[model samples]
Target: MDFSFGPEDERFRAQARAWLAAHLVGPYAGLKGRGGPGSEHEGAEDRRGWERELGADGWIGLGWDRAHGGYGNRGATLTQQVVWAEEYARAQAPGRVGHIGENLLAPTLLAYGSPAQRDRFLPPIARGEELWCQGYSEPEAGSDLAGIRTAATLDAGDSGYRITGQKIWTSLAHEADWCFVLARTEAGSRRHHGLSFLLVPMDQPGRIEVRPIRQLSGTSEFNEVFFDGAAARAEHVVGGAGGGWQVAMGLLALERGVSTLVQQIGFASELGEVVRVALRTGAADEPTVRDRLVRQWAELQSMRWNALRTLGAQSGTGGQGRPGGADPGAASVAKLLWGGWHQRLGELAMQVRGAPAAVGPYDWSADRPYELDALQRLFLFTRADTIYGGSDEIQRTIIAERVLGLPKGARPST
Candidate 1:
């Protein structure tokens, strides 16, 4: 892949950088570098408003086609999207509140949704007026999605389906306006069969409830969502009933799209801070610590190039013209690469801090029993990096069975 950006791409980068500088002001200025992974609970309403500010400038759906209410005509190339992500991170802008909707659901809808569904759902998301949370994992179905037991029955009036089940580890569920749920719609259907992807409104009175789960970092960005006969309109179903497996898989592929690149940029920032800490604390004087830091820098660069290569291949396939959709191997490899790297980076972060890492927040009041610094939060939160999303084991299995055509592993009885 060509590493050089054309003149037009450079101009786009300049425009993106300028816009971020101009708009990240006042209340938004303090938001820079806030609201990431473990710190998602910080200034959420402020971040939501920033999301709308981005939408107002037509910066929300950079990769979606114009026909789908995006900026495709003005050359929303993969390169340009990458440029925007880089600039966004460079500015230390607030983490996006609508990312789950903009990156995952909108693309999947474009690929598998009915015209009416797209017409109804795409506009609000494009304008950043709504936020979305994923409802794929349940108590029994974290990595093994086929084991999900969330069930939905068709309503008596046939206008929609009534969903009843529990979803755990639901990120941003407390703040989302909608949730895309995968529920079993066929009685007695097992595994991946009988599933439907239903878009559910989150504000239902007696039907939906969200309870935040406190993490080790003392934040409640993750939640447990209960659906007691929650209703999804008949037209709100994506990819038809009993056909949600494919649509859900497509959305998983999109989960590894351009956003991964943006995540790496954030990781780069975090790593830079670690390096500064190491230097300030004389950890860099240690040969092993210095070597590990150098290796991390090199590996991050390699990951960036690999992402560009994979996204370029996807674009060439005329698919959604984004990353990971065309190549499942690329998606799995990317996950495996970053998951372990992040976990290791977290370890390195603690190591560089030495004994200071072991201490908790100074405020131990009853109201604030526990608190964590940024590095402490990164260390604690990234321990789940290898577990959430898809897990290291699942990624390796995908590469082994799906990509390499290896024999299937034996399944344990539930």
Candidate 2:
């Protein structure tokens, strides 16, 4: 597939760049390069404002099909979408706060939701008026998603269901306005058979509670959420009740396309910082350190190529979030490639610093939180890189069974 952009794409890139340059100023000036994977605690309120700024200018949902109500704004061609992703990253714009709603939930709704369901949920996401968090991972079913025990019973009058269970490792739950949850809807059902995907509001004080889970980096971007009979309107179910497993899997596959470009850009910046540290500390002289850095550089380039290929395939197949579509191995392979690569980069970050990487500048005697350096945060946070968003083992299992057509591995009895 051709990877080059033409004159029209370049014009779109200029338009995206000019708009971001004009708006990412004034009160939003300080937001540049703030809030991402390791630094999610920084400037969250400002980032929310920035999200609204994006919506106001019709920049929130550029890839959604116009036939499907153009939820956020006008639809752009795949090339234009990629161009916008490139410019947004190159501008060093603040990490987006609306990505979960815009990228994950909105796409799923379009693919599987009824027109009524789409009409109700898509507009708020497009306008940056709502924030969403995923609720697939539970205390016992992080990787084995089918084992989720969270139950939602049909409430009185059959108007909705009442959800009662706990969800852990929920990213940005504290700031989310809603959560798309997977729960057991069938009383006697086990595993994936009886699960339902429910859209739940976060404002019920007595019913829903969010408690932040402090990380080693001293940030609480991940949270432990509790639901005590939280109400979910019957109409809010996506992909219909008792069929959530398919909907949940579809959302995971939506990770293809321009989102991959955004990730590669972030990886590139992090690598640049590590190289700068190596040069300043004279660690670049070490053959071993130099070898690892070269490997990182090469692997990053290869991943970008793979991402472009995947994007091309998705574009040919009518864009992302189309259920039961795209190469099954694509998402798993990307996950494996980046997860381990990021973990290794985090290790290299400390190795370049030598003995000083372990120590912090803050005095232990102080009662306040310690301010850790960038490298420190990266190292601590990446320890879970291989664990979250489907572990390395899980990805490999998927590729082996689904793509290679090998004998399926043993799964626990439901």
- For every model shown, the clashing-pair count is 0, 0
Give the whole-model CA lDDT for all candidates, comma-separated: 0.88, 0.88
Residue 190 displacement in candidate 1 (angstroms)? 1.1
lDDT of 2 by residue, 9-92 (tens): 898888999999998899899988888788988899999998888888889889888867667486787778878988887888
Please list the Cα RMSD from the true structure of every candidate, rounded to 1 decimal place: 1.9, 1.6
RMSD of 1: 1.9
224-258 per-residue lDDT for model 1 (tens digits): 99999999998898989898898898888878778
Please give the lDDT score at residue 158 for candidate 1: 85
